[model samples]
Target chain A: MTSSSVPKRSRSAMDASAAATQALYGASDPGLRIRSIVFRSALLLSMTVALIAIIGIISWAVVEGGQRLSLGLLTNNPSSFRPETAGYRPAILGSFQIIAGVIALIIPLGVGAALYLEQFANKQRWYNRAIELNIQNLAGVPSIVFGILGLAFIVRGPLDMGFIAAAGSATIALLVLPTVILASREAIKAVPPSLLEGAMALGVTRWQAVWKMVLPAAAPGMLTGIILAVARAIGEAAPLLLVGAATFVTFDPNFWEGGYSALPVMIYQYAGRPQDEFHVLAAAGVLVMLGLVVVVNSVAVWLRAKYERTW
Target chain B: MKELGKEKLMAESASTKEEVFSLDGVNVYYGDSLAVKDVSFPIYKNEITSLIGPSGCGKSTILRSLNRMNDLIPGARVEGDLQYHGADIYGSDIDPVQVRKIIGMVFQKPNPFPKSIYENVAFGPQTLGMKGNLDDIVEEALVGAALWDEVKDRLKDNAFGMSGGQQQRLCIARTIAVKPDVILMDEPCSALDPVSTYKIEDLMMKLKEDYTIVIVTHNMQQAARVADKTAFFTVSSNDEEGSRTGVLVEFDETGKIFSNPADQRTQDYVTGRFG
Candidate 1:
């Protein structure tokens, strides 16, 4: 019996050593220590790189544009020859109009689509699945593709609206609709099914239940989606170019007609110009665009916090 | 009016109470699979009927069917007659929403709207256009659910601020706000602590004096304590392909079902021999 127990005693001793090792380094294998350190360092390095890039861009824009940023930049109109005198007045107004139009278009349409897909559609049906898959794919498609579609359809084809600010708004709205829908659908799905059931049990119609309970529960998340979409819409230059966003405009744009210049389009034109003053102007425009996006996102975050529901 | 009320109560006690619901050969199916098979029973007005069974026995399914709650589930269909006041609930002209207005339900988990306590109780009445002094109606409903005393001071607070049991009672108050004739509870106390469960049990006993109550519970003791009648359900599985169906084995007055059950399965279940 002593001989038999000797090997068992050694095995237990080995287990104790393994336990000691795990307690020290979180793993039994000593080699895993180096591996875990290396893995952790790599992950940290990757995140640091992203953080550095964002900070560098913001700093560079502020430093480059700080001197040129002024009330004049906000008040004057774009001029190719007189870069110092030029401002983004028309572009600012036009961009605001486009954003407003995009919001008006996307909120109802995207939320409606999300509600129908998440709450009403029969998911087992092939067509519904196809529609869902297509929406996801559409969100990933290049914004330029949407611009082309808007140009061909809204500006030139059956609808035959002109190359107007509203046309650009339509294009951007179409570009971001998938993003809004996907996000809104996720928000709607996050609502506990119990809330809907409780409301329905009270004899309310299905629409009433969704309208009263699900929508309120989902409003915060939906607002976040809209804000992100708006940020994406405001920064897009290529799409607006395709939809005829004018590179140069001295006058404020009418909504449905006339030439319009957006901040991104103006920045693109200014940055391409062969002059130091124009380059500074481009940086200033970029800073303004970034500021607007930050403001919109801040508002979204505030709204989410204000309406956060625990359940 | 007080004398008239007493006289009516005496008459109602002397005569057999009216049946609120009578099920005849009911089989509930989700898509092609049967969940509950051949359930037949009568639920009398102003009495508590508890459906008790082991897991997967479809007690909740039978309770939900009474108020057409199963209609919310896609591909769920019920065959055979489930009558409310002698009218078939499955008839072509019968609206599920209208049916729900008369027969309210509480779920296993308490689900109050993320609104104020006042709003949570007021929602159903507001939506259904229940005309009265709104505050009075809310207070009366809360009082009836035995929650007014605890919640009256914090009526404007968020419903989620309440403890679990209070939230459950708030749900009960919300249901009563609409003045439903019958209330279906599916394991309302399962999520509560023992003390909270006792409180809800006491509340349900009081509720049965006004509204007919049907409860589905896993706790046999709970059924014995608060139920006037008991239905024991058990899972019946077919050997071929391992399909399971919930079958009602026995149903009787609570006393007889607990003390001297007619079926062997009921005796086994009640005596703790086997589920």
Candidate 2:
């Protein structure tokens, strides 16, 4: 309606209408504000709790073992009677050797399994579904159960490789294989289906498309997964203990047929002893293990940042 | 509607042009349900044939089936005669890979590999073992797509760094690097802006000199601008069975399909009366 054709209201009525409109678009109720604040605080509190636990553990290790952190910790060999001069030379070498083996075993096996499942397997088949279900379940199985299997299969029965660094590597690799496969599958799945179709439309066979385009696109993520899985394998002590990461070894580990000691197994042995000095040595071992894991995880983060694709 | 389309096709068959693809009573199915029913048409050599329709009318399905891209989806099946150069593409002995090598596709979205622009173009020729200087092939394909000048200095850069239109053109470059006879594009310009769309339409016009193109598009004006022939599809739903099937209402020269359509549905669609 035109302005001149409309009736004009009194000043009091106009004032009342203006006030109603103002109130209609005014600030939200106090209940909503309080609820929003509570939700945000809860989220912050959850993050704080996780951060505190990690920081607390790192600080505790530093306080308990800072005095023992020296060049001697890396150079000298372990001594049972003399904890003062003892170091993690053999244990450090042993951890590296087993990890190398684990990398060799897991890269081909884990990536191969993930590729088979993600790219080739028909989801309509019952067995492929069963295999996927089993791999997921395997990731959740206790690490000690893997130790038992390793003892029965690799160390003593069937393959009979004996208690050496190779056996320890095989056991830890088996324990982390499920994690690697799951992560690799996620990375492969993250590559767009359109990319595959684009490649196929160009006349490449399925394998060539996967090997050339799909794998390179998925490499950074797969590498990140491998590094994370290796980190988890590094800190595992229970399975290695059963697979024979010995309590004490003076010399460097032989990959094939000699005694070896991983950092975590040595730490566990030291913590079980009666001396306070040995407990400090155990804490020092924890520091070394934590450093290795942090370095590996940093590599993963850098690779992801460098190569992740937006489209 | 079906009879009118057939009559038009019969009249067009009097021409001496070679047919690259000939479909008769083609029916596409996903599982037991028919998705597109009785699609009959001829795609001639070096011609741009556009499929135009509203949503859920199986336009993309028909385009994808031309290159056997629908085989990638589980339970998707095609029936009736679909011949590529007088041979049944679906014959038991014909390898789908071989069929795809002859018929390449461009998708609705630009899906370049997460690699350098040079690598993206080089991948197809390298995989197919095409004998040539690799650099020259990539440069030629980029030139053919009208992208070489903008990207030649930055061939080593990642394909993802380009603009949307540039990336789509790079996808076109990658497809043509394989040297396929037919290129099937599924709504290639729907994801682009107006300028990019027209650029692609212009590219399509130039490309028709070398390649037989069958494009599915929601833009009717695009068909009018670049297409030599047009096929109009509409959805026919059965309320009792709760099913919708795509039916070809008309097929003719691009001029007649847009200006003087035979079927009422085609007339209404071209005039924007209703989808």
Candidate 3:
């Protein structure tokens, strides 16, 4: 048996040296059956659990918000409690207005800070170290702490902008600026230095190299970071609570004046109430809030895949 | 046999080319440690001059200093005068970028941008904001590097997909696109196969009719084949804190340096002694 097996084994081994060595572990191996089953089963289980959670939330929200999910939810102002009669129209518009201002403020400032830190600033010195340290510390600072600061500075003090949409946007921008700067820096740092030098070698100045090669390479990444930071700002309530978010508003407030109410601020106001009806409203508001976040983040993920550098 | 004409000598008129770049009493230092010491040589115009030395002997450093690539490194300093076109290259008014544009360099590694073949050639002219008929310039550069026919149809394709030799040629095309007066290459053929190396060597011979080519190479045979004048550099001082740097032991006609070098050190190195 040994002699018979040795000859057959050697013959098969020689014949299948390169091909079966890989194929055997892939489609040819019988031993991997159980492992494959387990691997696929685990993957299915995670996806199934996620789907179940999503379906459960949607069903619950629809059941509780059946009467309020119509054009009224999109058109009417927030209410203290009239159940089917109250609407989130003002809050929706206010949230969008705040987001616009936040985007306007963060795009230039965040990208500028990122470029300064990643490209121009010398990393080997104390001043740069201090700047890096401060940014990291700011990222972890509590949202409520930022709210109190916004209250003191923006709502009342020198900035005395009231609880206007612009004021809320400013507060949220400050809250998300650290995140945007950090993400933009990571994206910029990922751009190959060789590309920059290649451009500069051609006779293009340092600014042109960055504008033409480095920044474009980093664009898709920066866009994703902006989306995530914007999404986070959209969902913030603690900062908005102190600055000036009202529980009820029939009409959308203009940017610079009057009270504003974002989805989170409205959700918080409803959820904190003792009524069971208000709690149901809060859950429904959560679904609407989550939908907005998903849409924005989906666009970001799409853009990331679109321009993903192959080289 | 092709006779030498005034046009063939037209590019050789850097005055300093017959003596174009002169390094007199040049000492290169990286922080307090000297990397190259007492190196004196002349790079004639429109000639291929190769610096051959052992690895880490600072052969590349001398090449880099010619274009002030050393200025990029902190704590890197040079003592002694390096004159280009009979003017001080180390002068306060001389911008490194302008110097680099005039004296282009090709690294030992083939570093093509993640761009198309045509774009790679167009990069230099684009940087200089050269107007009108860029298509002509790109085509000329590709033809000059002898890569036009091979890459002509696929000029829009990414440059990274090409073979190492082709990529090196592309880099040469890039350097030449700007019409630099001198081209410094740091072991441009080290990463290429033999066939590719021959192609590049042939290209260098042709290019010498237009631009001065200064190269640093580890291949003694390559130097003998391609270079008109060869400078032999060797490691001399031996210690940690004061490690030996590359010294120019001999600089003459390539055949003379290989056959009848005057200095014993140069002879020992040329014949493969303690290189």
Higher-scoring candidate on lDDT, 2 or 3: 2
Error of 1 at B173 (Å): 0.8
Model 1, position A216, has a per-residue lDDT of: 86
Q: Model 2, residue A259: what's the lDDT?
A: 89
Error of 1 at A67 (Å): 1.5
Across A1-311, the per-residue lDDT of candidate 1 in tens digits comes to: 45566788787897899899879887557688789999999999999999999999889889998788898998898898999899999999999999999999999999999999999999889999999999999999998899899989988998888889999999999999999999999999999999999999999999999999999899899999999899888898888998879548899888888899899999999999999999999999889999999998888889888877666
Local error of candidate 3 at residue A257 (angstroms) = 2.1
User: What is each predicted model's overall lDDT from 0 to 1?
Assistant: 0.91, 0.90, 0.84
Best by lDDT: 1
- Kindly list the per-residue Cα lDDT of model 1 for residues B169-204, writing each as its tens digit: 999999999988889999999999999999999999
> What's the candidate order when arranged by decreasing TM-score?
1, 2, 3
B190: Cα error in model 3, Å: 2.9
Per-residue lDDT tens digits for candidate 2, residues B146-186, read 99999999999989899889999999999999887889999
List each candidate's DockQ score.
0.71, 0.69, 0.41
Pick the TM-score winner. Answer: 1
Candidate achieving higher DockQ, 1 or 2:
1
TM-score of chain B of each: 0.94, 0.94, 0.93
Per-model TM-score, in order, reads 0.93, 0.91, 0.83
lDDT by residue (B54-124, candidate 3, tens digit) is 87778998998987777656678988989886667788776777777778888887889878999889878
Ranking by lDDT: 1, 2, 3
